[model samples]
Target: MNPDIVRWSYAAASGALLALAFPPYSVWPAAVLAPALLLRAMRRAETPQQAGDLGALAGFLFAALSMPWLRFVFGPFAAGLWAFFALGPALFGVLLKRLQGRGDWLWVAAAGVLWAGMEAARAHLPGLACPWLSLGYAFAPAGPLLQAASVIGLYGLSAAAVAGGAALALAAEGKRIPAGALAIVAGLAWGLGERRLELKPQGRPVSVALVQDESYDVERLAAMTPRDAELVVWPEYQAGVPGGMVDRYREHLAGLTSGRKGVLVVGAATVDEQAPFENFAWVLGSDGALLGRHDKQHPIPFMEGRLKGHSDPRPVATPLGPVGVQICYDLDFEDGSRRLASRGARILAVPNLDPASWGPLQHSQHSGMAPLRAVETGLWVAKAASSGDSMLIDPRGRVTARLGFAGRGVARGTALLSDGGLTPYVAWGWLVVPLSLLALAAAVADALFGALRERAFLVYPPSPLGVEAES
Candidate 1:
């Protein structure tokens, strides 16, 4: 077969494999194999530019296969988003080709580091930066492997996987020792992760109810009593309760609150229509009083048109403990949740409303990530989604109870409440991103220096033994 044809085949296969690694399929091993295939294909590219082109093609294929849900969610604009995602992989290929050109000994390590750095950069790229499609997410189902996330966070797992894959690739290319060493490293990491799996639940217990109501009806609250739960949370933007309409819902909320002892967290669009509508998670007191409100700090871009995101995220005081609230996409970013956790938030209540059209694929993807937050902040996560996969995740990132998608019901569970101490991740998640950036800068500089040094050596070669003696 032609080398180009073979390379293209590998690229396409890798893309497909990566798509399968995510939700709906959740074939976790494919995540590692995907990058390994890509690395193998790029090894044949003669130039960095050619490698980048192949990467772009692979990325496009990956996006089209994996993220078909984006079209249903973002409409025609999904094309632009798909292209944006493809750019990261294209750059991934370019960096690999450039770094590999320098030498083989460090090429695999460099590629893995670059892969992680690219993922970090993509995550910080403002509106388009999606943390959902990250390579680490593929391992979310593997309980033992996910333990690595507690120390290095999600991006680090990606780096480790890519490194392992690259090592195996090198072995396939006739180097066996390095591959065996990398395998040992991977096994040790997994062993460490497994050790942490026996994490003891150490915190105050609190009962919570995650209500996934399609109608966002206040009437649903009639059944929830003080004995049922300490807090009841609804999914985000369940319905638009415009300004004039808010009074009626308030009346119903007041009735539900009277003589009760639990907090009712309602999600509704407090719409002004003329001004920017606020998507609020209103905390109604047990005695029919409005205690506090946490406006969604982060709204999904483009999908959430004209709704500006706010910066103030404080823990809401409840009968159980200080609870942190994140509305859907807010969980994607760490700032809001970390801030709340820092300020003594023991439990996290996330009100998510995923589209029914997106199906289990998107639901699984969204739900799988909540555990990372739980582990990162050492807080229990209670997520209520309007269209399924609602779950209660323990502090150790275990799913205790869950409701499947396309269902309408309340998921009742107990969440352990911490007194708010920073986990190592919360203290250090800020550092990983900067370090990744520096690593990327260092890689580029090294490549440039190597190229320059090669040119200098070519221009100023040492004289042959006899010629040097004459000189």
Candidate 2:
């Protein structure tokens, strides 16, 4: 077949295999589909170059399909970055295919390096840098498979996922050694994920109500004030206007507070002459007194607060719990989540303001993280979006209750607050970035070793004849 035809086939197949990688969508398709595509590509490669080309095609299509929403993030830059990311998967598959002849373990390991490195780069490059389409998420409901993330972070889960695909390729080819080894690794990941689901240092439950205020018009909000609700929770950017609207807005808020029997966490803008206005989550008592306020630590890149000023989370005192708040795009970073989690925050509340993004896939792509953030920190994450995805996530990364898009609804669920508090991930936030660096270094060392053994190294320690001549 023509090389062009083959590339097209690779792209189409990989795109098709990604059917269930996003939410409200199941992964039975991806689990079987992805491996089948990989197996086909693995068998098709007669040479390393051919394998890489096939891999590249697969990567490109994956990027185009999975991240078309990025175009909204930074316009053409989205496609450009996705195109760049697509290469990593292709290069990974191609390299693993080449190394497969050596041994199946080497094939899996090499692919791990390639795939994980790309994800690492995605965090470093892509707009707001969301890597939500990770293969591990396809099995997010399968708690046993996701526990590896607590120790190694998302990359570990990714490496395991790729290893599974590589094993499937080897298995199809009748390569027993690689097949058995990969199966063992997959089993181990499952065991770890299973063990951690019920594993809690602080085993108790807390009541949490996630408010989904959906998107509302600022103009309409300005013209007509909102009615009061009990123990009110509002979305980010929807609470108060951009400038000094707090005092004017207090009356409407007071209506919710004065009669309400509990606390109200309002997402709004608070301003001072000293510095620019900050997006804040104001905690008000039922009597309408300001109880505590957590200023949104991380802000949206271009939309709300400046990224430079707001990357770090700043928490405040609240009776319900130590309230930790973040704006949209802030949830993408683990550090911000950790900062809030560290400060005695039992529940993670995000007052998200989601604008209509560029494409359809972006919405689902963003929704996927609710589980990951919950799983990684072992904290219940309540996302209150001005748009949607207002949901309650348990410590195990399951969406116990969720609200649909653009709806005024309350999702109440039993979210266990940390009785003892703080998981290793919360205390040790992406200490794995450095460790990933180390793992990557070791992987590079092994690759270099392979090159030396294969005589692919250009500078062979001087030939014996040359040494004799020198003597």
Candidate 3:
């Protein structure tokens, strides 16, 4: 059998396994196996270029398989998106090939760091920061491992996941001692996370109501909202009212909170002659007074046309407490939620708009990020989607209440405000981005230096007179 065929088969299988690790299928063990296979294939590659090609192949397959819903959003252009994102894994392969041969344990550690660094870079790539299907997200549904996010953040989880993969690859190659050590460390982390889950949130319990419907009808949503609840959340763009209609709807929306100590968080498109349209969440106090408006930050690239909101996100003071507001796409990233949590936000009210046309797969995947955010920031997330999957996630990443996909109704539940201090992630997890960038730069520099040194040797052979080769 040809060695190249076997290596490529490993790459292909890795991609398929990685896709299965994400939402909808969510085979957790596949997450560990996928990278193990990819690492094995890369180890067999004759050159860095071949290793990168294999990585690209696996990444492309993972993207195509895991995120087919992108086709509905981007038509045939979805292929370009997949190819673009695949570069992350390709670079990881190149770095791994260059950074190997240090030691088995060192190589495994580098693989993990390189994988996480690439993901961090992918999440912040200029206008194309799409952090979907990240390796860490594979554990979002796993109760025990999911708690680790509260301490290390998502990128740390990603590093640990790939490290486990690299260790598995080593074990397959007869390096059992180090592989067993890595497995023990992973088990310890999981055990710690499991124990951490037992810590209960100590804070005031508030009744929250999530009003969800396919039709972004203000009347219908208002009718469905529970007045008895202290906080009522509506989905994103629930009212696409222009400037003229804002005043009328403001009065009507205020009526929902009238005669009760309730706050209404409604998603609306603010359009007027003075400025471009914005995806805005309006917070209405019980007395019909406007509290604070949070414009959707981190708008979806290519798809969203609204002007990007530049103001820093903070919690909106309400009768219930300081409630943070975030639009649909904002929850996908960590910055907004972290900032809000740091600013003493007890509860986060998210207004999402995942339409049914996007498919249930998209809805499930998109909604999974909420739990990650909840765990990372120690905030109770009340996400109300227009089409479905409205949920109330506790600080520990537990889904206390949920309305499944394609269903339209109100999800009522009690959310405990975050009373404990900021989790470790909220305090220092942002360092992951900079640390990743620094590590990536160092790896690239090391690779370039090595290439240049090798080229110098090739350009000028070793001197016969005991003289070193000239530069």
lDDT of each model, Cα atoms only? 0.79, 0.62, 0.87
Q: Which candidate is the best by TM-score?
A: 3
lDDT for position 294 in model 1: 85
lDDT of 3: 0.87
Expressed as tens digits, the lDDT of each residue in 1-471 for candidate 2 is: 895576458556875576455554656337435745664676576766677677676667766766666677878777776677666666565545556666557766666656666566555543345455666566665677665656555666666666666667667677777668767866776777777776753544555565665445433332222223323456776664435556566666665335455556667764444557677777776676787666655444345534234555665565556656666666765667777777776667777766544333555556676666776776778776665777777777778877766555676666665546566677675665566555555655665677677675456654689788889
Q: Per-residue lDDT for 437 in model 3?
A: 82
Pairs that clash in candidate 3: none
Pick by lDDT: 1 or 3, better one: 3
Clash count for each candidate, listed in order shown? 1, 5, 0
> What does the lDDT read for residue 268 in candidate 3?
93
Q: Write the per-residue lDDT of candidate 1 for residues 121-177, one digit (tens) a residue.
A: 887776655676778778878877877777777787788888877877777789888
Candidate with maximal lDDT? 3
Sorted on TM-score, best first, the list reads: 3, 1, 2
TM-score of 2: 0.76
